[model samples]
Target chain A: MRVLVQEALFDAGAELNAFAKGDTDIGAVVSFTGVTRDVSGGLSRMLIEHYPGMTERALTQICEEAQTRWSLADVLVIHRFGTMEPGDNIMMVATASRHRADAFAAAEFLMDYLKSRAPFWKKEITADGSEWVAAKDSDEDALDRWS
Target chain B: MIDVLYFAWVRERIGIPKEKLETTATTVMDLVEELRAREERYALAFSDLSALRVAVDQDLSDFDAPLSGAREVAFFPPMTGG
Candidate 1:
């Protein structure tokens, strides 16, 4: 298991390739990438703020939980902080397992938990001004499916 | 002394990201009340607890969580992470 909290941009394809390489026992590898979105037409950039120590701790805990619930071979989570433009990759999660079912379920579980559990906040900057993105009720509801 | 940290709009409103302070408050809510009484900025920042979330020692916790031996406390809005 590898969990990285960084500000530098990462290549999703390369990370996926690295995570999937030389794993003879693994039958399925699932990867998910989150990209910054321009919800409003004027979105210029996004400022992601996070609790330095807590962000990593929470993400690690989420990944560990996923492992406990699924028969995963390995997991990789990389999340970016600081400034980013729309269309930029914000984070990625990869899960390798002996079967496709476990890989897919674990990947979805990680995403659902990461949405509200991680200590990261996003502020969208547009032509008019900047505003912190509000947490959606649907995101909170998404967690219930896993429980 | 306990380290108090704020993030996102809470940091913007409080005008600082983190601080070290001595307090007698025994719980997260008690500490919040103490800070709210200190200045208008804190009061405003904490006025709406429904919009805020608290963490004790870097773990997501409740406002009523005990702070007896906690070394750090953080306040922020609900996470918007991916």
Candidate 2:
């Protein structure tokens, strides 16, 4: 398991390749990448703020929970902070397991927890001004499916 | 002294990222009340507890959580991470 909280951009494809390499026991690998989206037409950029120590701890706990619930071979979570423009990759989650079901389920579980549980907040900057992105009720509801 | 940290708009409103403060509060809510009484900025920042979340010792916790032996506390809005 690897959890990375960084400001530097990462290549999703490269990370996936590296994650899948030398894993003979795993028969399936699933990856998800979250990209900064221009919700408004005038989106200039996004500023992601995170609690330095807690962000890592929360993400690791989420990943560990996923591993415990699923028979995962490996898990990789990389989340970016600081400034980013639309279309930039904000984060990625990769899960490897002996079967596709476990990999897919663990990946989704990780995403759902990361969305609400992680200590990162995003503020969208646009031509109008900057506003912090509100946590959606739907995102919170998404966790119910897992529980 | 316990380290108090704020993030996002809370930090913007509080005008600082973190601070070391001595307090006699035993719970997170009590500490918040103490901070709110300190300045108008803190009062405004903490005016709506529904819009805020708390962490005690870097773990997500409740406003009523006990602060015994806690070294750090943080306040922020609900997370919107992915």
Candidate 3:
């Protein structure tokens, strides 16, 4: 299991290949990459803010919860914070297991939890002004499927 | 005394990221009340509790949570992380 919270741009392809390499026993791997999207108002940038200590702790706990709930061999999570262009990558999660079902379910679970549980906040800086991204009720409701 | 932190728009509104506060309030809500009474900025930031979330000692918590020995408390809008 590996967790990284950084401000630097990372190559998602490299990370994916690195995670999928070796591990002879693993039969399945699932990954999700989140990217910054442009707002209808023309996004100039997206500023991500997070709690240094708490972000790491909360992500670790969420990953552990995923492991507990699924039969998985490994998990990787990388999240970035700082100023980013609309096309920039925001974060990624990968889960490996002996079964595709387990890997897919766990990856989705991680994404759902990360959307609301993580401390990071995104502010959309558009042509006119900047506004904080609001949490969606749908994101919170997505948790119901797991329980 | 405890350290109070704000993030995102809450920080923007309050004009500071964090501060050391002297408070006798026991619960998170009480502390929020004290902060709201401090000035208009705080009140405006905390105008709607439903749109906000709290954390005590870096752990997500409720407003009714007690601050018996907590060293830190954070207030922010609902997280929009992915």
Candidate 4:
């Protein structure tokens, strides 16, 4: 599948290479993987929440828009939901194109849109308490750069 | 009638992931007010409107926008996506 959003974690290198092989015209592939961090003072897990029907729709829309904006051969996005421990793979996005420019730009655009526009929420579990994380001003500012 | 959804902490407070409600609200704020007045749980969920974000038809939108023809509306805490 071009887009896969699930509750299970995956290996980034394996999935990316597996999806980008045997396409002679695909000269470049750019990918990004988000991984959970190991912090000494945290609760030990990250909780991710997303709307069922709407999550898939929003992802498809974002991927379609990226394809339109860039001359890419294929795009793959994987985002994992539910409770996850530190060091787990949270998400990945890969873009394949005939040239490096398109692949690079499309991959960056996907992350920008996903960060600002995707409908996922995360809560950080700390040693003493858990807190809902708020959207960062930096993330909003990043989207503004594209606009 | 519209199907309203809640996620994350908003869902925890509201005590439901989704609900179908009948309303004649012309704007999102109007619907929020109706929800807030329904009971204490709703009030707590919507106590601070600024902390809440909304989406109409799966696209993020502001609460002041009219909901005259909306089929779905979602409420959740300010997004921490990335």
On lDDT, the candidate that comes out on top is: 2
Per-model TM-score, in order, reads 0.98, 0.98, 0.98, 0.92
- Two-way TM-score contest, 3 vs 4, winner: 3
| Model 3, span A1-147: residue lDDT tens | 999999999999999999957889899999999998885749999999999999999999999999999999999999999999988999999999999999999999999999999999999888788889889999999999988
Residue A8 miss distance in model 1 (angstroms): 0.7
Query: Between candidates 1 and 4, which one is better according to lDDT?
Result: 1
lDDT of model number 1: 0.96
Give each candidate's fraction of reference contacts reproduced.
Answer: 0.98, 0.94, 0.90, 0.67
Q: Please, what are the lDDT tens digits per residue for candidate 2 over residues B1-82?
A: 9999999999999999999999999999999999999999999999999999999998999999999999999999999999
**Ten residues in a row with the worst lDDT in model 4 chain B?**
B73-82
Q: What is the per-residue lDDT of model 4 for residues B1-82, given as tens digits with 9 covering 90 to 100? A: 9999999899989899999999988999999999999999999999998788899988889989999889999998766655
Give the CAPRI class of candidate 3: high
Candidate 2 residue-wise lDDT, A1-147, digit = tens: 999999999999999999967979999999999999998889999999999999999999999999899999999999999999999999999999999999999999999999999999999999888999999999999999998
Interface RMSD of each: 0.4, 0.4, 0.5, 1.4
Please give the CA lDDT of all the candidate structures: 0.96, 0.97, 0.94, 0.87
Global lDDT of model 2:
0.97
Q: Write the per-residue lDDT of candidate 4 for residues A13-106, one digit (tens) a residue.
A: 8998798788898999999999877554555798998877777777889899998889989999998889889888999999999999999998
**Candidate 4: which stretches are off by over 4 Å?**
none
lDDT of 1 by residue, A1-147 (tens): 999999999999999999967879999999999999888889999999988989999999999999999999999999999999889999999999999999999999999999999999999999899999999999999999888
DockQ of all candidate complexes? 0.96, 0.95, 0.92, 0.71
